[model samples]
Target: MNILIFFPSIDNGGPTNVVLSLLKGLNKNKNINIHAVYFWGDNDNNLDVINSCCDSIYKLDKVNLKSLYKLLAIIKEIKPDIVHSHCLVPDFFNYILSLCYSYKSVSTLHCNLDEDYINEYGFIKSHSYKFIHKYILMKINNVVSVSKSVLKAIPEVKAKTILNGIEELKTPLYKDNLDVINLLYVGRLIKRKNISFLISCITEINKIRNKKIKLTIVGDGELKSILKIKSGKNISFIDFNDNPFACGVENTFFINPSLSEGMPIAVLEALSLGLPVLLSSIPAHIEINDKMTDGVQLFDFNFESINNAIESMLIDCNNIGYRNKIKSQFQDNFSLNTMSDNYVLEYKLMLEG
Candidate 1:
């Protein structure tokens, strides 16, 4: 079978990682051919990896009217058995093209479109975003949500829940002197992410714990300037990294204080490295803790709650053996192999249906 994967771009983000993981995992299948196309991107790290994963790659320059025609032309040429897409724009075009094409179409709903658009675009514009997204999603041939939280977001559409997975590399037990506890947050520094509060909570945490807390904020966004203003030397910011297991994995704890998430890839990457995670008690994170991962702990979006959770982890830090269990749990549930196998099944079902 020939499968063509489509996405808006190949940036170093969760959606891109999903595309990469799917491509890499599916590329191993001898019976199937994997092809991929993207609108625009410049993440060289991911670009190289994507090039190596797919049998063919199409760069459409940018998302525009001309690109739409270009994409339609590619679909005509490829004549894939199934066309699977990621992200909003690609999903839209994939659905649009499906009207005139014979190939089965599938799209991965990476986040809760309603809340996500509200956070990014705000009230009025968000309505339009939500309306358009809902329409396209409903019309799409097959829909897959990265988490049950996301699946719940769109009750109108029939979507299969397949939680996002990550590429796990073998990591040795790493401790950065144990004097400083590295708290990591990977992904965009957006308002809804509530990262500013995370930085402030570290202050209260440091005051209580004997060890100082260091926060390494990864990814860039509009909130970058605000986060810089709010943070001191203890908090350092890095541009977007494909890696979330920065600093030292053993001493580091991944903390995401987002108001929402849809199976965040960074959290999975950190867990793969056996880094304990303290996530905001959002539905998505709660779903992960309750059903998916054993190592994740949820904290309410408050200083007391976050500080207490940090203190508990710090107290239990010396019991390094548990980190291995976290890594093992990751392999069991959120590994790329498991996700790919599920997607392969879904692809077959889409064809059969």
Candidate 2:
């Protein structure tokens, strides 16, 4: 079946990794055709995923109004069996196409579009926008979300909450070097992510324990320059990489003290690799902690809580029972194949209805 997948970019963030993995992991039985329309440059890195997996990829200048005409023409030609859009841009276009075409349409609300956040995004802040979201949710054949917290933000629209997936490693790494327990944070250096809070955690933790804690923050964003100037000892930053899982192995803890999130693919990947996670007590993080234990721990978005969690975990980093429990739960349920199969089923349902 032909499936057109729309998202902001395949170049950055958890959604990017989720999209690429899903594009590659879906059914081998079906004649799967993927149409990706993104808002970023079609660089070699981005095309690597598309060329290897998708049937066709288009990176249009999203800000250009004329692109809509071209986009409509392409959709009309593809005549896909189903259309799946991830964010606001695709949401609007898919609605437009649904009006002109006969194919079924589906959308994933990957983030919280609550009044608080919507207010910051211009005209999207209006009551009419909320109406449109509800209208689409009622009209669209199937609606899926990465986090229940995201769905809760828009209570009028009931949605199926499917935790994002990750591919587990066959051989998990165990590096218990006392000199350096590598702490990792994966995501853009944006305000909402609470990047500064991480630094505070590290500093406070060191003050209490005086242990060697090195941090690697993977991903660049709007706040990079100021963040660069502010960063202290043992903290480093890298641009968003498609292969961020490389860092998952041997990392003592995956830390994400974000103000908000959909289900974070990074945390899932880390847990899949048997790395313990320390995340903000956001609903998305709490929901993905399948073990129901503090193995996948949570703390408030503050230095005190983060420092306390780190210090407490340090005392038991080698607790075999805790590690095994986390590893088993992540591998069994959050595997990439499981998520892809669930999505494929959703698509089939849309086609049928």
Candidate 3:
């Protein structure tokens, strides 16, 4: 099977990681010939890993009518059996191409942005985004959502809910039971991440414990400077990396205070490493049952609530036994093999149809 994966850029993020994991795992299958096309400008250095894993790669340059002519030419050449696009823009382009010619196309919705993201990103308030997206789903052969939360955003659309999987790595050997508690936040530092609330939670937790809590926030973004200044003693920030699981697993606790999330892989990595998770009371977080994770706790996106949850974890650290059990369950449900196999199955179904 010849497959084409389209994404905006290969920059380090959840979508990129998900696609890379799929490409890497799927490449090992001798039956598949996978290719990746990205829109970002030429970056041979960034494309090295993708080129190594895929059969071919392409880039989009201009946005005018001429670009569409180039796109159609590329499609005519590759004639991909299955075109799997990630995110909104690529889906739109796939929708246009599907109308022009006969091809099996699939889109993976990574964000739960019904209207929130459109507004936040300054996209026109007009329902055009939804209209185009719905039109694509109605016309395209298949669509996949990374999480139930993401699925809910496009209700009634013909789509499958396939959870994103984490690459299985050797679990970290050391579990911190040191004097100072380690709090970790792993994700892009943005308003949606609720970094401010995380900082407030740390301050509140310090007040209750009357002790120093070491914090290591992984992932850089626009709010880096603000976070650094607001960070109390013993807190530090690290830039985002393609592989952040190891960095986050080093800490004792992983805090996800995001206002929204589409199956955060960081939480999964933390749980897999036996690090307790403290997640905000977002719909996405609720979908993942923490009772399965003994030490994982959920709280409203408030400092007091987060502080209480942290205190609960600090008080009963052995609860991590349950968290480890949950992590194992996640591994069974969301391993890279399971996710990639599901896509392969989906592709077969599309072809059969």
Residue pairs of candidate 1 with colliding backbone atoms: none
**Considering summed lDDT, which 10 consecutive residues are worst modelled in model 2?**
115-124
Candidate with maximal lDDT:
1
Tens digits of per-residue lDDT, candidate 1, 127-237, equal: 887788888989988899999887666799998888887779664655576777778888888998888888888876666664578888888999999889988778888
Native-to-model Cα distance after best TM-score fit, residue 169 in candidate 3, in Å: 3.3
Residue range 1-353, candidate 2, lDDT tens digits? 89988777766566777787688776343668877777775457756866677777777675556777777877888888888887767777777778888888888887777632543354646556666666777677668988778887677776787767866755445565657878888877777788887787787776677868888888887888887787777787777776664654464788888888888887877777667888888888878764446467778866677777876777667676777777778866777888888888887777777
Q: Which ten-residue region of model 3 has the weakest summed lDDT?
A: 242-251
Error of 1 at 88 (Å): 1.7
Give the per-residue Cα lDDT of candidate 3 at 108. 90
Candidate 2 segments exceeding 4 Å error: 63-65, 115-135, 169-176, 245-251, 291-294, 321-325
Question: Given candidate 2, what's the lDDT at residue 1?
Answer: 87
RMSD (Å) of each candidate, 1 decimal: 1.9, 3.1, 2.7
Which ranking of candidates, highest lDDT first?
Answer: 1, 3, 2
Instruction: Please list the C-alpha lDDT of all candidates, in the order they appear.
Output: 0.83, 0.75, 0.76
The regions of model 1 sitting more than 4 angstroms off are 171-174, 208-211
